[model samples]
Target chain A: MILTAAFFSAAIVAGTPLLFATLGEIITEKAGNLNLGVEGMMLMGAVMGFMVGLKTNSPFLAILAAAVAGGAGAFIYAFLTVTLRANQVVSGLTLTIFGTGFSGFIGKGLVGEIMTVDIRKFFAPVEVPLLSKIPIVGQVFFHQDMFVYLGYILAVLLGIYMYKTSKGLNLTAVGENPAAADVASISVSMYKYLHILLGGALCGLGGAYLSLVYVPAWQENITAGRGWIAVALVIFATWNPYKALFGSYLFGGLDIIGFRIQGSGLAVNQYFINMLPYLVTIIVLVTISFRKSKKNSPPAGLSVPYFREER
Target chain B: MKKQLSFLLVAALILSLVLAGCGGNKPAETPAEKDMVVGFIYVGPIGDGGYTFAHNEGRLHLEQELGVKTLYKENVAEEDQEVMNAVADMIDQGATVVFATSFGHMDGLEKASKEYPEVAFMHCSGFKMTENMGNYFGRMYQARYLSGIVAGLKTETNNIGYVGAFEIPEVVRGLNAFTLGVKSVNPEAVVNFKTTQTWYDPATEKEAAKALLDAGADVIAQHQDTAGPQQAAEEAGAFSIGYNTDMKAAAPGAYMTAPIWNWGPYYVTQVQAVIDGTWKAESYWGGMADEIVALAPLTELAPAEAAELIEAAKAKFISGETDVFVGPINDNEGNLKIAEGQKLTDEEMLSMDWYVEGVKK
Candidate 1:
């Protein structure tokens, strides 16, 4: 029973970062901008957050540094794809390369340095008073670190903002048909820049989570392609922040289930177990494609640059 | 006009990428004209805190001790073409000696050695050689065995979790020796083993460690890179045995000891040999006596008796007494793989693929 509880608890831990990154991508896509620089932005966030955490020994400053660094990366993407009319895909890929190299170069001195700050406890789990009285769900969900709680709050708030607000409807209109939204005076560029920066900030939070809360260490390429997984997760969640929450946990659960079962005297091949998360992602994508739910498809303007003159 | 502007931007981007790909970091101003330039190719970033970090430490030692100028290319994929490209790049930079520190670089180094006969090439943990190339690795299993004794004595739960990188002979050999060490001290203890199949993915490795903790293992031992497992054990309030380097700082509370490679002394010797014109193509597997492999100092987390126990076992390794893989052994399947009063020859140890008893995979 303890093992089962631990598994679910860990699932949330693993999923929190994914939830952040996926929601970031969803918000960006909804702004008619498909910023594939999630990986790069996260690295900037991870390194900056870790560096700040180490130097100032303050988690608050570190968190702020991570968000700003990630937003800075998105700012570059927005300038290239939005202002200069550069190809979104090419610019995003370049950002990934740049972020990878930049982090490595800056983080060279930090490689093996023992973190002096007790950042782990700063992000450690805090049990909710009333929720702690419940059963398995309480232990798994409510009794989590600050970062996990942040993920839950962010997901629900984003869900409400996207579906229940008039401003969100304008953002959706800008994504589905930017020309129509432009005709309605919605200011398409403003929405894209605003949300893309917001998206970048969230992705940075995800990266900070990996360095500060997950491994709590600075290593080169520390994200290890998790940013890419979060991108796929955006599609899996069909741009719904709430669904993205569950999707992130589902993927995170599968990621470590092999390890949990391997200790139980199971004969499962570990290599196959390691591939479980990616495999499930592919299967979900295939099943979703077959279902042909148009509502579940991507934002109409995703990856499409809007030019007023062309429209 | 806008079309022309965007076209120019795209062209500039592509050109910059191409330039970045070709540009290698130029080494510090060539040491006095007589200084020998050494080159290193690593399979992972030097920041890995494990395998590549140890190798980088060796390179630094080579620079400081011998005053030889050094250049390195890190995170080179273990592909023959990529290894060759890195080798070619180093050779282009006037490197007289090259070290390829990954098993997969063996073939590439073989071909490069033949192509550059005047240059000395050394491959780590591989079995390929040419006139200009040789192989070198430490008997890390010796240190592994000693640390295993520490884990065995320290664990209160009797459930020791081992995170393995791959099931190859090198890893398997270490796993067996460690389990044997555990069984020697505590026959009732079980070593729960799981492979992440990756050398240095922190998140994945940490999860694997957490899984072991959930399964009731109180002591975590890892044959993988990164301090991820150590961090996991520390978080769980469990003891940990590290590998490759001392990881006490990574997990101050959880860290017990680690089997570390002291490649600096050996690197100094090999590079000095090259300078003396006595370099030869031979496989060198140095043991504890050579100081190439040694155990990290046991921490307060280790049992008080662990220090004496480890020293007694380490003495045998230094004195050339009992080896870790002495016979009278059985594979996990209960098949007698070796007879009593016998020991595994170097050839047998090199090709070991089976697990010893009490190692649950």
Candidate 2:
């Protein structure tokens, strides 16, 4: 039981960045925009965050810099997709390639540099007075980081805002049929821009989490495909923010399982174990695709480019 | 229609010329009249400014010092089938010798050697070799052992740490050699090991270094590509030994010396062999005596005794009077692998997978 609790704790910490990115992506997709530049935005955020944090020796400012950098990257996507009406898939892939090369160019010198400021982990467990006394359940719920608690709260709050509010209905309507929504006086372009930037900010924060709170130093290619995993989580969640939290934790658990198994001196192929999370992600995506239930799903006009004459 | 047909005909003629240029065709010449063309395939980009850079420098030396014509493909992914095609292309282009500077490139080189029996293939850090293919690796563990002596002398906490790239035998042997060298001087020292499962993850290497430092280690050594551990050591006010290249600038205050591979002499010799038609299939594992494996100059911050100890060890190794993996060694788990007063054979060292005593697994 203790070992399980330890594993869960490690999983939550590891999955925090993925959860943030997935949740933000869910919001962006909700407004009918598909942003494949999450990985690019994340890399930019990581480099900017580390540079700022190293210079200022302040973790808060570093995170803010990361968000700003991410926002800037998203603005590029918005200008191409929402304004110019360019192909979303092509733009996203181009963004990823450009971001990867740009980040490497910018971060070449910072590769081996020691981080000057130590960013205190934002997810340290908080012990509630009354909840601390319970046995297994209390230990699991009460002893988690502030970010974990905030993630759950945000998920529930966003779920309510999307399903129960008139503003959310307008947003969903715009996503489903931009021509109809424009006729109904809803600005589809505005929603698309807002959601894309929001997604970018979230991805930036996730990237910063890797350098600051997780590894706590600057490194090239530090994200290591976490951005792609975040995209996969969005699909596994069926475009719902609430389910994304669970999905991220499941992936995180698989990652830690490999390390734990290797640590225990268990006779297992580390390569196969290392590949477990990626393989499981593919399986989850396939299952989600096979299940045709549309309880909470992608926006109807997700990947289609909108033009004035499209109607 | 006649004018259009003429234009098409001209375009076809130009296209054929371009294709011929890409095909690397030249007028047939006698072997004695042609300059020996040697090709090199690097796993990483030359701009990496580290491992691949060192190899590129060696290739440059072959061109400048030996006057050998060299061609190279940088940033070639190890698993890409294009590597084999590239090798074949080099051979077609009149390369007499080809060097594959990556472990994963071995199978590709082996396959190419079987297809082209006339060309000599030399692979770095690979176990398998064919009649035309030979393996070449430096005695990096010798330098690691010497660096460990400096770590042991400098550490105030009696705890030394090693950040390894992978758990492969090459890295494993380095870790064991370093631990043994540290124990030689500081008998009470304990070496902690952490594997990041990658050759170039700066973030993980930094984190692993911090973890070791936090656990009471004061001297850190790494078997990784980047200088992350060195930077981490400088930040934490711990001493560090670098790998592959001179990384003193990365962590000036905390920098000790690094065990760097000098490939220039070997490159010159191999190219000379090809020119003289005396190139033979042989594994070359040279150390400081041959100047293949060398220790970088000790930093100003290094302990006063470091230079003296390193000099003694260098002399002993050069004189063939001392083997780094001598007897009275024990595995990390406390199993006596070598009896007292018995020296470890070269075959045993080649297949060594166990750690010596005083190392934490």
- Going through the candidates in order, the fraction of native interface contacts each one reproduces equals 0.75, 0.16
TM-score of every candidate = 0.95, 0.74
lDDT by residue for model 2 over B91-197, one digit each (tens)?
77678899999988988888888888999999998888789999998888888889888988989889988888777778888888898889878999998887778
TM-score of 1: 0.95
For each candidate, the alpha-carbon lDDT, in order, equals 0.89, 0.78
Give, for candidate 2 chain B, the lowest lDDT window spanning 10 residues: B24-33
Give the interface RMSD values of the models in order: 1.3, 4.6
What TM-score does chain B alone reach in each candidate, compared with the true chain B? 0.95, 0.88
- What lDDT score is found at residue B68 in candidate 2? 69
lDDT of 2 at A170: 83
- Top candidate (lDDT): 1
| Model 1, span B1-361: residue lDDT tens | 8789879978998998798767656544444568788999998888888999899899999999998989998888878788888888887777889999998888878888888899999899998878889999999999999988988887788999999988889999999989988887889899999888788889899999999988889999999999999999998999999999899889999999999989999889989999999988889999999999999988888999888888899898899988998889999999999999789998899999999999998
